[model samples]
Target: MNLDTLKQLDLDDREISIYMTLFRLGPASIRDIAGQTGVNRGTTYEILKRLAARGIVSYFPKGKRRVFRAEDPERLLQLAEEKQNALKHTIEQLKTDIIPGLHHLKPDFSSGNVSFYEGDDGIELVLKDILATVAHQPEKSYSVFSSKSLRQHLYRPFPNYTTQRIRQKISVKVIALGEGGEDAEYSERKWIRTQGQPDASYIAIYPPKVAMISLASENYPVATVIDSVEIATAQKVIFDTLWQLL
Candidate 1:
């Protein structure tokens, strides 16, 4: 019998081996099962005790000695069902108890908030937050200062970000700082000619927040999210002024 699926029930390799050996050999003493499975007698007896407690194995007295054997394999399906029901209960508890308690611990946004995130996964989180913010707002638009170098860094980790944004119908007005970005479906591009290489960074201005992202090749990718209405409004004004000039 294929016993690989037994691991899902949290059985270790030795326990699985001993159980299968018992299943094959019928009722057997610990010494016999241990020798067949190559596990020591003491450990095999402990494993059998655990399996018996879980109803996966049963023990009966053979004279003065106890003989152990596997229960029906159908017990595995019952164990899986129990695990699934437990997961559903945990989800319900989180929704009803845990999340509400967490919401009460949120910090005040009026004092201004700054969050630092590092690595590619951290950058994706910031991008996802931006998308979520725009998705909830009525305006459905945001502004970006798109650096060519930054895009090169970002495309590798988030190739489908733009596609997902377009699919959500969130529009962006972009001020391209270097070369070679085409207008996408939900975006408008305005170019700013630079004398030399532009700084390797991107700025995203959205409602009540602004995000600054660094695309430095010397280190891991990083992003900073500033949650302040005053700062975001000022950045939006500056972007608009440059948008008109370019």
Candidate 2:
């Protein structure tokens, strides 16, 4: 048997080969197991020792020769359970120690970090994080929309989103570029529109944070965000300027 399934259980190449060889050959001497698996004798011995301690294998003496046998295939499922529990426990412990520092990273723009999100779940989490940080503040949010205007855009949900925010007394000022030039989601609000200022960009201001989504389809974006107070203040100024003229 190939080691494909066993590798995910944190088994090294030699360990996997040794385990599979025992399962296939059954109750064999270490010398024979090593020969069939093409694993060196030293590595095979070490892994076999570990496997025996884990209760996945047993060694017994028949007259003078030592014979090793696999415990059961059920041991693999047990190993998977052990891994899951260990990983979850470790993650919980790490949350208090490692995650706070992780969240505290300075978003130094020059450092060049990029995250590629694949599905709706990924995009939702990104937007959710933005909303979570900005929700408590009573400041206006500025946004630039792109594919938002295309036939399959997020037009319907956006208007409701704005109205809900307005009901919550949070003002939203948007400069819709290409698609921002399209129809309104709610008729009561007049949108300040701007388009084609050399580069295609979508801008958003959420109090002390600002984000811009750009140049991609519903599946992805060439986007950026800034959480600096000074930068956000400057964006708010630029947004206010256009809010006046447009």
Candidate 3:
């Protein structure tokens, strides 16, 4: 049987092995399960006890030793449901209590918070932050200043970025530095004339934050996020002014 699904219930490799062995051996001793599964008797006994605690296994006295039996397979489904409910409660608690508590530990951003990141993975974090920040805003919109050279590498880490933004009903106003941007849902674009392809860089002005991404040597990506109302407002004003001129 495909027993991999048991892992979702937090069963480790040895626990699953011991449980499956019980299913096959029909109420076996620790020695019997250990011999079949190649796990030592001590580890197998420990795993059986863990599974028993989870209601996935049970045992009865058989003279000198205990004969452990696999509980009904349906117990696995019940365990999964219990975990799901626990996770939902945890998320609610995080929203109501844990997140606010954690925020108290954050450093002051009054002097302008700046963070740097490198590589595609780092860029993806910035993109996700954009979506998350904009989604909560009353206006649900942000602005961008993007260069043509940087456009191709920008979304490598997050190919579905536009799709997610559209799904969230977030809108964007973009100022294309050197042309070649696509029309996308909930987005408006304007262009700035340039003599040649400018150095590859992108600026995302989401209120209280601005993310700047650029390509380094060998087309590697580097990014910085600035978190401060003053910095973001200044950037937004410049973008708006340039946007109107364009």
Go through the candidates in order and give the C-alpha RMSD of each one to the true structure: 4.6, 7.7, 2.1
Cα miss at 42, model 2 (Å)? 2.1
Which residue runs of candidate 3 sit more than 4 Å off their true CA positions? 110-112
What is each predicted model's overall lDDT from 0 to 1?
A: 0.87, 0.63, 0.91
Estimate the TM-score of every prediction.
0.68, 0.57, 0.91
TM-score of 2: 0.57
Query: Whole-model lDDT for model 3 versus the true structure?
Result: 0.91
lDDT of 3 by residue, 119-184 (tens): 999999999999999998999999999999998899999999999999999999999898799999
State the lDDT at 75 in candidate 2.
89
- Residues 88-166 of candidate 2 have per-residue lDDT tens digits of 9989877777777775784655433434432334444445545565666654344443333332333222334445555
As a whole number from 0 to 100, the lDDT of residue 178 in candidate 3 is 84
Residue 161's lDDT within candidate 1 is 90
TM-score of 3: 0.91
Residue pairs in collision within model 2: none
Positional deviation of 178 in candidate 2, in angstroms? 3.6
Q: Model 3: number of clashes?
A: 0
